[model samples]
Target: MHEDAARAFYAAVDEGAYDQLEELLTPEFVHDRPDQTLRGREAFISFMRDERPLTETRHDIEAVYVGESELAVRGTLRDADDERLLKFVDVHEGEARISAITTYTTQVASRLTEQ
Candidate 1:
């Protein structure tokens, strides 16, 4: 179930269906990345609209592992043209609705400023 939710979440991102994410994420949902942490689903949506990071993304889901309190997803982020940009593992927490997200990706981290 969580695996499906994770896939749906990524699918929403790839399709730019920002509104669709509301159903998959909790009101207090948090998105954690190497560079920043967005608290609340609204904050996350705002970031998505502002940054548009996944505009060219199409996640090639490698696997989804169900953990005690989280679902771990491994995948390669590809561009619209099917070019792999980076590999990542995202931890999704909570049941029914995703409450928290923690992403680990070295490729994206290297792009962040030291400051």
Candidate 2:
């Protein structure tokens, strides 16, 4: 169920379905990254709407790890044509809402998928 939720969240973000975000996130959800943290679902939605609006974005999920209350997915963030932009691992907590995201822009050859 968490896996499905994870996919749905990513799909919603990639497709720019901002209206659906509230249903997928806790009202007080927190998103932490290396450079910034977004606290609360409204903050996340604002970032998605104003800062990270990439309508052609897609995730090619390669691995998923599930724990009692945590879910993690490792994937390639790709363009509409499937060209890799970054390698990322998104971590979700509390009812499958994403809590953190770590992204690698520096491609380690092992992580890159040959197009």
Candidate 3:
């Protein structure tokens, strides 16, 4: 069930159905991005709307593991000009509503300015 929920979440994002995502997200849903963390469903929705304006977004899931109310999805994100490997951990409620999401990017960050 967790795996299915994870897949459905990604599918919704790929289809650009931001509204549908709300159904799968918990009220306290938290998304951890590379730069910051977004808390709450409203904040998450706003974040997606602002970030995902791409021509396309695709995810190729290599594996999915479910444990209790948690799901781990290992996949690759493919777009028109870039491809990124991503690993996502989703904590779900009884009804598959994602309560939290932690994502990791394969890209390495370089320091632009020395502190």
Candidate 4:
């Protein structure tokens, strides 16, 4: 269930469906970015809307560590420009909700020939 929720969250974000984000995030959800931390669902939605416009987002789950009431997904995000490794920890009550996300980006050069 936690894995499903995490996948759904990524899918919604990739699709630019900010409305669906609320369903998967906690009201007190906190997002820690390189520069700042965003609190609440509204703030998160706005942050994603204004900052990250992912042309392509993919997640490859390497492992899942389950705690008493939480699940941590270790994975990577691949786009056309770069790949980012991420560890997403979700806290669950009944349905899964993203509590925190830590990510690191890797540089990847384009392979296309210049026109």
How well does candidate 2 match the true structure in TM-score terms? Answer: 0.77
Q: Which stretches of model 1 miss by more than 4 angstroms? A: 109-115
- Number of colliding residue pairs in each model: 0, 0, 0, 0
lDDT of 1 at 99: 96
lDDT of each: 0.82, 0.72, 0.68, 0.61
Higher-lDDT candidate of 1 and 4: 1
lDDT by residue for model 1 over 1-115, one digit each (tens)? 3788999999888787898988899999999987789999998988776665446668888889998779899998876677777789999999899999999984772323333
How many clashing residue pairs are found in candidate 3? 0
Write the residue-wise lDDT of candidate 2 on 1-115 in tens digits. Answer: 2788788888888878877767888788788764467888989889877775355778788998987887788888887777777777777787556554444434533323332
lDDT at position 87, candidate 2: 79
Q: Specify the poorest-scoring 10-residue window by lDDT in model 1.
A: 106-115
TM-score for each model: 0.87, 0.77, 0.76, 0.65
How much RMSD separates candidate 4 from the native structure?
Answer: 6.0
> Which residue segments of model 3 deviate by more than 4 Å?
53-55, 81-95, 108-115
**Native-structure RMSD, model 3:** 4.5
Query: Every model's Cα RMSD, please?
Result: 2.7, 5.4, 4.5, 6.0
Count backbone clashes in candidate 4. 0
Put the candidates in TM-score order, highest first: 1, 2, 3, 4
Worst 10 residues of 3 by lDDT: 106-115
